[model samples]
Target chain A: MSTTNAVELRNVVKRFGDIAAVDHVSLEIRDGEFFSLLGPSGCGKTTTLRMIAGFEYPSSGSIVIHGREMATIPPHRRPVNTVFQSYALFPHLTVAQNVAFGLEMQRRPKDEIAARVREALEQVRLSGFADRRPRQLSGGQQQRVALARALINQPEVLLLDEPLGALDQKLRKELQIELKSLQRRVGITFVFVTHDQEEALTMSDRIAVMSQGKVLQIGSPTEIYERPTCRFVADFIGETNFIAGKVIENGANAATIETPDGLRLRGLTPRPVRVGEPAVLSIRPEKALLLAPGDARAGHAFAIPARVELVSYIGSDTRITVRLNDQRTFDVWEQNTLSTLDRDAYWQPGEPAVLVCPPDNALVLTE
Target chain B: MTLNALERERQRRERRTLAALLTPGLLWLILFFALPLVIILVYSFMTNGPRGNIVWQFTLGNYVDLFTRSIYFNAYLRSIWISVLTTVICLVLGYPLALFIVRQPPRWRTVLLFLVLIPFWTNFLVRIYAWQIILANNGLINSALRSLGLPPLTLLNTEGATLLGLVYGELPFMVLPIYAALDRFDFTLMEAAADLGASKRRAFWRVMLPMTMPGVAAGSVLVFIPTIGQFVVSELLGGAKVDYLGNLIQRLFLRSNPPNWPLGSAMAMAMMLVLLALILIYFRTTTEEDR
Candidate 1:
């Protein structure tokens, strides 16, 4: 990723009559970057990607690819290609023909077309399967064919609309890694759209978290994971415990919040919080530790009382759900790193426990 | 070994059930259709009676005259010409309309498809007759032209009129099949093509046209077969100017001054041969991709 902007959208808005499928989205995708538009279905991530690919004309504003304005140009005239989620391999063409379609459209010679096709199929590791029909290939092979077809065009940017969405779990994971490495090898900017948060975090150099046709945050995986700007981002990206509170003391870098149950908690904030304003304290499950009474007093910043309601033994971690004194629930994820220790057996349901977290790790955000 | 034996017994019982289910349709076809075809084949070789009836005497003269007679041979050519024209015109007109209908919203698609089938609800002959009222020189169209002080166009009793009637009669066959193909068509392929640097026109030709070829072939066959042997449209619209294969066949069997049963049956057999040849040629020549 570099400072050079390969693709830029300027306050682009797209409306399907009354529904704004993409609303005032403006973001710059860096050169050679794997940028993701991540959100739930109908959250306008796909719509945003479509607008950039020129399949859709934005209702307002403009899109520029490689510094050229692309607002009125049709998809065919644009200098970008897309891998449709369905693979969309031409049913009439063999795998070789499908990959060579763009070059043939450009009027390349037969000799060059053959060489480039072989090279493209080689990149996707499908060199031997040239004559096979698209229907003759398995799902993963078809996906690779789609990728090869788009990449062979050598556009300034490549648009992928959830390309691995239709594959099985194991195949999807395998393709996720393959696709990321493939993007790096080609060094062409990739604008990937997916609703799967884990997939986005795993593959994207930067992610544009979206909801309801609006971009919520644009950041790296660690930034999005540890320092989310809002409660929605925190909850959507991973499991989070939202503790309802009101700001009792505002500060430049840190603030104190009074929980509804009368317990006071302090946490760091990137943005200033006004005193007496309603807020929510966001904390990740793994950050919240179950204390053995006096074990947390020397270092932990805050402590609250809770009764264990349930304990789930996940292989890598032990998850415990505890109900706070005022009936609000809290979740704690304890890593089962100690050999020969079954943590689920240690935490009895209905037993009283203390939940503690380091102050710097908690995120306090205004609702 | 016991499991294999049990599976074989299960397969035997399933075959018996399938045979029982197929018995009615197979019997109906053999008794009603096959028997009539066999009788017609036999009748073609027999001699005509003294009073325009079958005499059951073996003769080859009818078959000889079938090719030597110019009127009968010419009718077959004319039928081929008219059927080809009808198929082409129906395809040219129906494709865009079917493409338009498929793009409609799901709710509107149902309504448009229903509209495509609406003409079938009325009696077929009654609807054909209604075209007579509309296409006549003194019909509603010419009358409207006259009221506008425009010169009235000759709209009926010409080859153009016959062609128009055939095309109109077969249009729905073209539209419905193309529509069905477009209904199941994956539209995203068109987008993928465009993204691959194909212009809108190229994308449509390479992707949309080839993808919908099955529907086009089905619709063409539907329109072609029926119009080739049809006498009604030419009879009503041709006004004695057009004598198609069907008109010639009817004259042989039903409207002959003294019925030549063997000759008529020979003409019928010749027509069936032409029809069979056409279907074979069509299936052999078509370029649909094999699955």
Candidate 2:
């Protein structure tokens, strides 16, 4: 019922036969915000976007777009447009005709349609290629045409279903910035669906991470990556090293878990945990630092004495595998800040090191 | 210098290979098709003797006769009209049927396309005779009408029956090409059109029809070319009541007394020119769409 939201799905469920493709899901997408549904294939993200576009009707509950209920509406009647993953540009029409199609269907004046089509094509930077057929254009150019074709309508909400999934890495990166800025320029709410976590983290104002037809978490990129509340979100968002232990103490702000070796680990808990419950302490590889043994690094909550088993020097960071006291292999990423090729400057195998676990960086998560 | 010689030797081998691969098809066409067409073109201008023989004297009298005679002129018009009408009807009926088949599940699509091909298993002449049995005064339809206490109307040997037979025979040609086009068609374009605010009907006209036009042109050529030159349907179904170009050509060559082979050759050449024009137009339109 809130008009401020560009799109609202309230307990929506879409079932194909007896299996639920999209389980009961509720979401409120803020007007003029770039929201993304991030999930792997078959996670119901595309189905949810299709329901909002009115291509698929929900089996239960309601979908409201700009205060209008849209379960029974067809895609054409809905005040929204989708940039399909395949670009789906009409092969028969020229670029200009394709961009002008929505205006033509609205019965707009021919001169107006022509002007707007020119402006829209220019917006996509395809002004010089108006008369060319779609087959003649390159894939990136075709994708831009698809964007212009949808954006020319200026709908209440623009839905993009993995539009950049077909582009090469360089082009995807270029268009990611272009699309984010274009959303800002047009000031239209965009509901983007993508399986690429880095893409969602880079472009989305807020992301809803889905799995098995349910939204596991909905937060900004930093919030989802840094402070994941559940085990799935913690593991799915980034590379995380987990320590399985039973909860020894549950407090208001943090929880403590004891490993079988009687080593206690304390971490911030986003959700409440009951004492004596089995839980996992999730720590990202980048958050942990590796120091020489007996270094006594200040500001470190807990330091475990371990031996560096393997070391890999990537350009940005050096990934080190260290063995903990309980024989569990822990991954630690040390940023390569210094410019040096000296072999002595890096950690070598069998070097005894201390793995510093920061108090604020780790999260205690339960299933 | 050695590399240059090697490249030259490779090019010679390639040329020989190309000639070897093309020789059979080239020889077949020149002997069976090109030679007959040249003979037809040559005989179209030759004189016709009193006893069904080609005379040595070269003349343009057959061409002049074809242009001036009302029967040939009317037959040309009627044949063109019937062929065009049949192609149009096949297109209108076949597009929907092809779309229906394409929309089915993969298993059902195979089964439905099989059903379309099942009629081809029967002989074309037998199917035309089947149509005759269905359309005759004492045939299936008329017999049913008679049993219903209704008057048995004349259904056989009419233009409608002839048209029905032609369309029924040529409809598969139209449907198969359209089905192939629809199968290869990316249906996501329909969803794209819908997302662009086009109604389902508008989407079909703007996107579906134009995209599948190559198939339409191909099917039209396949149907029209054969239907225009066809004599059996009109001969058996129309009972020689209407004189089409095919029937006129047949009568001049074989059926008429002291048959006029030169006139028949002239008529066949004219029909070929008309079909050549149609095919040229078809190619022009399809290539323009590609551009």
Candidate 3:
């Protein structure tokens, strides 16, 4: 990707009367980046997307798109097109006509408009649906038509506002793959807005995790999932066990915290070194290993004595709800790669086990 | 065999219930609408007696007289012209109002609709007379003009006055249907249009206008047909001066020395035919959107 940012929001704020829908939010969406604004509903992700699309103007600050200031620019005049959450296909128009609407608005040659519209439809794998009305198509087909309509414009930035949100899980997965590859082939900047963290992690190169109208962290999926900077970021992205604690020993590369029940947790950290401060140890269930009694220990792995509160086989993984000796509960996810045919040897409810998670896997956050 | 017998009994009972459900509406149409139309048709063929009573003799004279008279021909044309004007005015005013109402917050939408419907609480005739007071030369409007030291223009008993009254009376008819269409409209399509580089004006024309057209068509039909047959507004607001079909029909039926029941019935039949024809044309133009 080029050095130029495709879009930039400089401390943008949007207020709905007394409430700030987007509050002093600043971010850079690089050119050709599959950047996503990931958050729950009413988190200002969609509002930020709308502001970039020029459907909404920020109450304060400014948005610049492709080196041009987008302040006061109407949606149509901006060099960006959005695939709305509802798909928003024009019901009166045929699929081809809807795709051609933008080029025709710009008064392009009829032949060019027709050619581009056909190409767009083909890109979305909807070539034969050109003459059909929007209402005549299935929801997935209509969604493809919406994508084709926006893409046909060949705008600088393509926005998608939870475009796959309404689809069924299987259909959403299919579209996620299709959309990611489409973005790749087009090589256009995509600023997707979605509440589904899994969808964001799957499709986007970088995600901006947001909450309460503010961006908490912006990082790659691995970075975000592995080392969330705050409790909300750690909690929002995936299932994590947050054990409240006080920092006992702080090192340059690692920190140890004493928990409420007097259990100490040592974890990796690149943040500040400070002792006697409130902290939290974030551990993903997948990263925490469950070892039956008398199992050989990895020298660097921290082991905790716990009893299974709940045990359920979930095909890919066995989820064990464990209550620790410290009187705190934590969930440990064990991949069921090993044969579970020996039902008697399997960890039953109330069975004792050692929760062995590597120290490096834990993230100690002092936020 | 026992199950089959029970199923047959249930089907018979269900059929009886269905018949019972349909009877009231069918009976009402027969009693009120179909019977009145048949009586009007019969009256058109009968001769008028010296008094207001109908004569038993069958005659084609009423139809013949209606066709031959310029006063009746001119009156029909005038009413059609006035109705057309009123419908057009209503459409022009109602469309933006419907759009505005639909875009308002959900709480204000009901309040705006209530405001549109509030005028219906008063009797329609009483409302027409209120318009007369507003339009009269020495009434509220002209008096305001006179107090401003401006020359008081003739306001009542004019074509403008009649047109204004017709529009005023029929406006709610137009607004309601258009509002209903807008209420069911999905605004996302308009946003999509704008996102695809259509200006506000272009988006409205390309998206908003076409989708809401069914509403306009329904509203126009509602306003046009009734406006053509209206008599009271023309009488009060036009000060009985306008030669509209409704005023002319009223004169022929009630004010003549011998009430021309046959001639009036003939005129009414023709007016009904015209209304039916207009509706037919409207239906022809708008096939079900099906989209």
Candidate 4:
């Protein structure tokens, strides 16, 4: 893939009267990368996508697509296409005609348009269904037709606004994988917008998690999940347990924090933490281990006494919820394997348990 | 078995009660609509007597009189031409207004649509008279023209005045249905067309216009059918020089010597038949287009 940026937003600001729907924000998406804008509803992710597609204009700043500033360009004049959330296929036209529409609009040769439409249909694996209208197709097929319509234009960038949100869970999962593969095969810059973090994590090469009209953090899935830069990112991308603590020692790569319950915990610090500063230590549920008493070691693990609050068996794994003396709850997963359990020995309610999570697994957030 | 038979008997009694409840409306239609149409059919065959009453002597004299005279044929042709013209003008003007209303923001769309209907709330005859005053020789239009340094032109008592009245009176009828159709129009289709590289104008013609055709058909029927039978506009504005089909039938029934009742009945029946044919054609074309 080329290292050049395909699309760039430079301090873009969009406002609806007094309300700033998209605040001053900037981002650059490299060509051929499948980038996702991940956020909850009303977070201005869709507005950002619309700005990129030229459906909306930024109140300030500039959007440059393929090195050209697109301030005065209309949607139809822009060399970018959008796959709308609703698919938005033309009900009156057959799939072939819909796919050929862009080519026809460009006034290409009739035979070339037909050939390109056939090729696009084949690329989306919808070759035989080209004769059917959008209403005649199932939801999945209709979505594919919409994709074909956009892709056939050969736009420099394709903007997708929650394209898989209308499908059921299973269909959404299937399409997520299919869409990722399609993006890879086409090797085009894709700017996808969705509120589902799992969907973004599964398909995106990079994700920009946004909230309240601002981007909190942007990184790869693993980096975002393991090392979230803020409390919101840690909480939004995955479930994280926040424990209030005060910094006791600040080192080059690690910091020692004293928890409220008089426990000193050591964690890796991506940034410097001053001694005596208050911080929040975030630990993922799966990172915590359920150990028998006396199995924990100092400096490597912090052991806490708790009681099992709830246990749910989810086929391949069991989730155990434990409550501390302060009444704070935390979840730990126990994989169901031959050595672990034989339909018995599962922790039930009121049972005492020890939760042991490694110190390095905890991430400290100061803000 | 007794309980089952009792339930069946109760259902039969309920059916009878439902039928009895519906009988009044059914009887009213038969009396007012069916009975009058039958009476008109009978009257179309009878001759006009010396005392301006139907003589009950069956003849085809009225039908023969319609074709044998040039004045009646001309009046019919002129009425058809006027109705066609009014329908065309309404379509051209109403389609854009309806489209504009539909494209407004949701809150403003309701307010604008209410404005469209507000003009219709007044009495129909009062509105027609208001138009007559405006189109008169010394009315607002001529005075405005004169003040603008343009020569005063006589507009009333002309075909233009008749058409102006027809268009004004029927504009709401045309706009409402077209507005309804355009209101329900799927805007996403337009975006899809644009994404496919269509210009704004091409998208409008290819997607927006075709989708709103049902409204056009409905508006045309609503405007054309009523304007064809309108005598008030032509009579009040046409200065008694023009003789549309409605004026002919009105004169024959209420003012002509010997009443000319049979000929009036024939003319009324012919007008009704033409309206029926237009309605049938509209329905057929609209249904086929939908498919």
What local lDDT does model 2 show for residue A329?
98
Off by over 4 Å in 1: A296-300, A306-312, A342-353, B1-32, B42-69, B281-290
Candidate 4 clashing pairs, residues 3+ apart or interchain: none
Categorize the docking of model 3.
medium
Backbone clashes under 3 angstroms, per model? 0, 0, 0, 0
lDDT (Cα, tens digit) per residue for candidate 1, span B184-236: 78999899999999988999899998888888888888999899889988888
Query: What are the RMSD figures for all models against the true structure?
Result: 3.3, 2.4, 3.0, 3.3
Per-residue CA lDDT of model 1 for A1-367, tens digit only, reads 3677998989989999999988898998899999999999999999899888888889998999888999779999888999998999998899999999999889999999999999999999999999999999999999999999999989989999999999999999999999999888889999999999999999999999999999989999888888888878888998999898999997788888998778899888866788988988888999988876567473547888889999988889989999999998999999988875654559899888889888887988874
Estimate, for each residue in B1-291, the C-alpha lDDT of model 4 and write its tens digit.
999999999999999999999999999999999999998888988999987888989999887887678888788888889999999999889889988888889999999889988977898778878877887777888889888999887888887888988898898899999998888888988887877778889998888887777888899999998888889989877766889999999999999876888888887887888889989988986786566
**Strongest candidate by TM-score:** 2
Error of 2 at B210 (Å): 1.1
> Model 4 segments beyond 4 Å from truth?
A94-97, A108-133, A271-277, A296-299, A302-309, A337-354, B1-18, B39-70, B105-107, B143-151, B288-291
Order of candidate numbers by DockQ, starting with the best:
3, 2, 1, 4
Worst 10 residues of 1 chain A by lDDT: A292-301
- lDDT accuracy of residue A277 in candidate 3: 88
Which model, 2 or 3, shows the larger TM-score? 2
Q: What is candidate 4's lDDT per residue for A164-195, written digit by digit as tens?
A: 99999999999999999999998889999999
Model 3 lDDT per residue over A235-288, tens place: 899899988999999888899999887888899874664798898988999999
Worst 10 residues of 3 chain B by lDDT: B282-291
What is the TM-score of candidate 1? 0.91
